[model samples]
Target chain A: MDEAAVSSLAARLADAGITRLGRSLAVRHVDAGSCGGCEISLAGAVALRAGLTRYGITLVDDPREADVLLITGVVTTTMADAVTRTLGAMAPPRFVVAVGDCAVDGGVFKGAPTVLGGAERIVPVDLLIAGCPPSPGRIIAGLVALLEANAAPVAAARRSSRIEPHA
Target chain B: MNPALDVAIASAAPPGTAVMLDAATWRSLAAGDARLGFVGLFVSGGRVHALFTDGSAPLLLATELIANAYPSIATGFPQAAWFERLAFDQTGATAEGATDRRPAIAQGAAGTDAAWPRFIETAGEGFYQIGAGPVAGRIASPVHRRFSMGRFSMGRFSMGCFSTDDTRILRLEHRLGYAHRGIAGLMRGKSPRVAARFAARIAGDATVAHAVAFARAAEAASGAVAPPRAVALRAIMVAVERMTADLAALAAAVAAAGDARFATLLGQAREQSAVALGEAFGHRLMMDIVVPGGLALDLRGDAVASLLAALDRASLVVRAFAWGRVRRDLGPAAGIAQARARSIRALAASVRADLAVVPEGIIAAALPAGTGTALGAAESARGMVYHWIDLLDGQIRDCVAIDPSARLLPALEAGVVGLDPQAAAVLIACYGLSVGAIDG
Candidate 1:
């Protein structure tokens, strides 16, 4: 919660060859609102015997079990609550990666009345995957970068001030 | 022009003609006509128009309601359910006496206040509800699924959240509209050419089909026809798009069944088609390629040769996969499994049929300025996509792009129920319905 904790978090993230959580990183993807293109590329990357699993990354269904939250599409107002709930459900040392142009900043649908812009509008994003729908290769690279950046450390240090436990 | 007639004489304009009708007569015809396919319902020019076709007919019928309030055709037709919901969402036109009147696409405070479908507590013993995502797994479109479960088995299902009484059997509920981008409003006031881009974006997977349908609608409204060469080229695009979509669907089905090798091959084939199309056209998705009256780009020189080469290569690879084996692998585990296989065969046959047409001539033609309502249709990977456009003084007054999702969703729900959870998941993957495509 203090400046020292923030600095330590940044230092831990910047270091290479260090596993932050000391375990396999489990990711859960939440599609706020997308045209379904990004998921195609994501599927390609994470299919059986593909890149994600080779790196010890697991695609999970529940948010509570995940270490990283991969959020896609523009965060529609209807999905705002779901997004918040998913983000909140993640255990400490969790990361949120905004995938696609829509998730980062709403892309082509930014100003639509139904859209609330991007994933950042609802929750803090640790990394942003850029593209109308980022190619599988690019998505894999972004995930690697976020993993190397130690999302867990920042997540762990910010737990006290960043998220309030539900009463 | 006969108010009482079910069939209207279509105008010779490129777009199909409209039939004006009193509200009472229109509702009756729409409900009573068993042969008619409910294309879409929309509000334009202070009247609600329902698009319908018997499939055997050459013309698409537009039955206009004289009053804002009309009886719900879905009550009788069943297929008109989502179309009516869309009409209400788009124009605030009410479908009187409709069974389900929940807003289809509108979300947040501007429309429905509750983002989640309000679950009604069924007074049944030992049944609990499980909810699935607005943000589901890897797929991009946001849709919610709620299932009433009895221990290990699944009960009734709902999509987009409506209450049901039966709590003992497996029923599915789908909550779509989380992917709403206001595409209808985005098309408003734009030129036919400009609006075509929005149509293309309606579903990235079905970009070419949407674009062609929009282009045809524009051409029809403007009294112009795409040249033979353009039509041939457009057919090629449609065939290639269908191949890619089928490959993707097959890949997803194969993957769900845990066949990594075939899944990867199908995925590669899907990507190959996209790459081939991108090399031929400008965009990978081929968005904005088909413009009003003609195509935005012509296939020429090396582009055509290389594209042809890719198509041939893809065709050989597709055939080598042995689609029959894929269907056999699916067995009866997945309900839509056979349907998906049948789709691939039908698509392949169509593609082969299209390839016989040599494309060489004037790619585009000049479209004349005109004013009229017209209907256009293109066979997409899923089903027939229809576009109805009303033009006034060369400007689009009202337009509707009807994707196949609305008609297919109920069938998907029915297919999903009673299947084991694993099988249901596979079927869902195979169907590949985009919520945005349905609700946009």
Candidate 2:
């Protein structure tokens, strides 16, 4: 996507009322074993221009406080345990987003003895953003899709509960 | 050739010429010059080859192993310690009499005990140790650090002597290899064109640099020159990659210094560059666009105009954040950031110049089936990256891609000594260490 489309998307994300739903999304990233391409795009996603932060999405340093776990790269043998532990640390209702072809299915690194394929080999991935390294716009779109899919159910439950109480 | 064996070859010599020397001569030459920079050491075809450069020329010294042991250069050359350890781990060729015999890359394999590598113990009173990640908190590659610190107490409490805020780092040692994907092993037996993919992914940020280096190495080995247009395109990509890297470095530095506004502006500029590259090339980070013989594909229509416009936009942002002004305001803390900004400005100009002179011709030259070995070097944003490849019947027999991070990581470990934790972290960012590149 071009700069103008990304800006409009950022505006829509801000108006999405993600914060009004009562909790800001907290994302924690784990680089299982990446060439770091995904990390760059991920950083761009949170940077001022992409402005995911303006929509109440914050990148947390600690996994325990995170609501979503964003994983990148092929899960290397050495880092598999750490990735598992990171996911296990998050609370219930946590979402795992695999943000690269590597994390989806090891991308170019597949068949390497050191790699154990994608994040699915070790943990359940809720969403997959496929690219050698997905662009920031794509990453933002993925997050938006995830939040929208999740928020609808919560919104419906709240509306029905209020109507039944009144009736 | 016999007479030339006694002396170092000139830089202008053919790429893969190695001077075969006996063990004694090899050791003496390694011990002779403090000016000789140790490039890399690798085992190919049951023989150990050590590459060293005297600024202008590369001198590759090969020695036959006796009982899988060769003379240890780590003793005379401290920088060779990691290389020797890695060489031992990958191949069982021991650097005999080396002081540090620890496994470098083989520590954290699949079936092996996933234990942390042993760190050096500093025995003394009031000294404490703190360990940081195989997984960093930030969006960074995995590498562990052991910091030995000494605490100073301001005053003694009634219970005991309490340490104050005067904690000084005594020593910092890093344990890498978490990102090791067996790149060299993966590249083995594949044609250079196929192996170029592995090379490009060696380090994501340096994708263009590594791809160019690998291509040059393949071209040199196969004795085929990339068309002038292909060379120009490679140069443009390299410059663009450099600009992005510099911008990232500048952004990190400014962010650390709490200049979030400037950091954001830099980030925006970087985003523009990424977008333009995606439009011009197929990929955002431009991964796998460069092949062995030449570019995998030529620039799309109107690519030059879009790329130039993006570079112009980036240039404006960089100039707006005046390096001199920022340095004067932030003092020495912003020194590295300012330098990076200056580099970005220069690279932008270079890219513009390169685009104007891009010759029209075929983008690729066919690499003939050949048998040869060669060393290729490319100046990455961080520093010089070297790729040495041995080709047998058009197949990559052995390959070693040495990133500049190998040397910088050691320097960072030493430079952070006596620095406080926060300052040390800043210094680490300033060094821009690439764990993926180093481990691979």
Candidate 3:
């Protein structure tokens, strides 16, 4: 429930109209080792505000059937095997959207003695909906951007490269 | 409707606590009301001991001594359908008059009827309807579904495993994800902490339920209870998470209902508080905080104070959004949704009657009005999960996760099948569906 920072980040993303990946699109869900907060928000995007159908993108049940893959939850050790198996099942050019902080940096669980950090540890991500669970509108905006004619997400501004001396 | 049994339940079981009724006698008492709601009977000592939740503690229904009984609640409560199949699948207990009597799911019962039975939304007059994957969302999960529409549509079933039986009459058929991550299968010989994370994903919203359930099951075998502090931590964590999910769903629902402004407000409420959860909890999902014997660590002063403060702020935002804005928008909108639902129900009923699709055995069982429940746990993110749990022998007998979305799926379907296709997403949002949680 302590989400002040997460929410601030999400609001910034929303106001920036930075929701699209390439073009707005429908996303299929994948639960690696999630408590399901990301999946909850994904449903909210389509079922609640932007209404997926309103955006002309709808959810299908097969990875092969989807244009985008929204991965939520933590990638658990037990699920490590299944995660690869599922990724293999998706069609080529599959887009992956990491929907929660767990999927991003493994969030609070980064250094747990028995935890796997972030979804990137397992699958390639296209966009990230960062929060313990991101807000639905923010989620919808992200999806909408993906479908827009100019739907590709804006690349992050490059940071100055710095070298640290290793003594 | 056995008077003795009824009297016993009234006398023994209090309101709101769960109790295991005499397993044997439940057969006869349930002869007619195959569509039972509150009580669940686990059979062992030739007596059917009912487990009823009595707001406070478990109430044991009077013992029911019997030999043979009818099992048809499968037709009434949607979730019971899965339970009956699971029970028949796992324990070999038949929910007599059930469909697919063969083993529902097998431990090693592969290539047998015990394998997951999958079906798609087909058999209706249609347009070349082609739907996508099971993991539908702003992001998707690796779930599959089986859809059988007219001729062109193809779907597969993807999900997890459960020991279903006629133990309870609360079945909800999940129409998507036939091949979900098989974490249960992978945990065959793995260590406990490793398996805990896998269990958490069994049902996303029910993370605590599954995690706690697995932990509880482990405790049963280990003969060790968590420290008082660990127990409280688990309780608090689950409650918070449950509340978080519920608010998220509500915010989504508000946005879906055309109150975009309120939806935005909820966004701030949800997104703002979620970060705090990330700060204290190692993983937002809090995967391995709990293990068989006890917790990984304790919540001391600073951690506790910070958590409480975060909770207060998030609560303030949520309360303001709920009372200050959404309540106003929902009144009229709810009316429209209700009317739409009534007509949809009427239509589905007529079609069901015409097709003679009445499930054999039990009849006329449907999820009740005000069946709405928002169960909250502090540690869970999507907030309080509203679900129906049928536990047998302290095991997950069968569960119908009625979380916020289940109620919305039917309404969304109704809204879509009859009205503006443009509002489909709205209906979906209003329904609180994340695709992963939708069950028929």
Index of the highest-DockQ prediction = 2
Please state the error at residue A94 of candidate 3 in Å.
7.0
Whole-model lDDT values for every prediction: 0.70, 0.79, 0.47
lDDT of 2 by residue, B1-440 (tens): 23333454443366456767767766675454566677777777778887887787677878888899888877666778888888888888998778887778676454575644578797777788988887665675688889998864334653265455567787898877778888899999999999998999988889999999998888888888998888989988988998888887777766665677887887778888888899999888889998888888898868778788888877888889865656654444466666777888899999888788788989998999778998887777787788888999999999999888887777778877767777677667666768899888
* Per-residue lDDT of candidate 1, residues A87-158 (tens digit): 898997788888888899987787888789989988987677787667666777777665645656556667
Write the residue-wise lDDT of candidate 3 on B125-182 in tens digits: 3322334334343344333322222222112432132232212111112343222233
- Per-residue error (Å), model 2, residue B147: 1.7
DockQ, all models:
0.33, 0.58, 0.16
- lDDT tens readout by residue for model 1, B1-440: 34355334334233356666556566675445656566666677677666666675434444454467777777667767777777877787787888877667666465456743455553455567766677565543478777655433332444334344323326677777777777777776667877887788778778788889888888877879888878887887887777677677777877777777877776765665555666677656676778887888876545655555555555555566665666666655344545554565566566566656656777778777668777788877788888878878777777778888878888877776655556666777788776778867
TM-score of chain A of each: 0.77, 0.79, 0.69
**Model 2 agreement with the true structure over A133-159: per-residue lDDT tens digits:** 888888887776656555655677788
Give the candidates in order of DockQ, highest first.
Answer: 2, 1, 3
DockQ winner, 1 or 3: 1
Q: What is model 3's DockQ versus the real complex?
A: 0.16
lDDT of 3 by residue, A3-68 (tens): 454455445545656543433454566766565566655655554434566777776666666677
Interface C-alpha RMSD per candidate, 1 decimal? 2.5, 1.3, 7.5
Candidates ranked by lDDT = 2, 1, 3
